[model samples]
Target: PAVPAPPVPAPSDREGGRDDDTRDKLKQASAALDRRDFDLAERLANAVINSASPPKQRAAARLIHGQVQCIARNDQEAAQIDLRGLEGFRAMKQRLLNVCRKHGILGR
Candidate 1:
């Protein structure tokens, strides 16, 4: 008998598609933020922010976006993004608010 080749994965299965990429980017963005690599975090988050990703991914990106802005002392922009994206993320909302409050921003 001849040896059989393994079947290739379809587009939907390849790297789990764009949603996965969005998710990966969001994870990388968050990690980069935690690592204090604000520039890379900003770039990753910006990619997800500008992409047509799901709301959750965008929300996560927005969280990162706000955090980076805060680190950069862009209080106004941070407040805007954090407050808007905090809708479905209760814990994150509070955390962001606390961080902003600590920095004397306090989103409107």
Candidate 2:
């Protein structure tokens, strides 16, 4: 009889789901922000930021979080978050910057 091949492993075994989980959280956060669900967006972005994700991923989360703050007119908080992830936001996503600028986080 021929030997059977090994079974394929499923994705997101929890132990190996750190990055994937955080990536999904970030996507959800962005979607929430797009939907103007600031509370949900902030919660999901905070989850990604507090996870053991790579620095780049965390930075992306910060960007979303900052946008939420800007939308809520929390300029100080948005500025602080922007400072934390300056390099990532330096890519100048016009819409994000515009939101910050409108809220005075990026200055007038």
Candidate-wise lDDT, in order: 0.79, 0.77
Q: Which regions of candidate 2 are displaced past 4 Å?
A: 1-12, 92-96
Question: How many steric clashes does model 2 contain?
Answer: 0
Best by lDDT: 1
Give me the overall lDDT of model 2: 0.77
- Candidate 1 lDDT tens digits, 1-108: 998999986666754678888988988998999899989998998899899887777877877888787766566765676668769887777777777766667645
Lowest lDDT sum, 10 consecutive residues, model 2, at: 86-95
Cα-based TM-score, every candidate: 0.74, 0.73
Error of 2 at 19 (Å): 1.4
lDDT of 1: 0.79
Candidate 2 lDDT by residue in tens digits, 1-108:
999999997765774677788888989998998899989989998888788888878878878888887777576765565556746456634556777878777675
The positional error of residue 9 in candidate 2, measured at the CA in angstroms, is 16
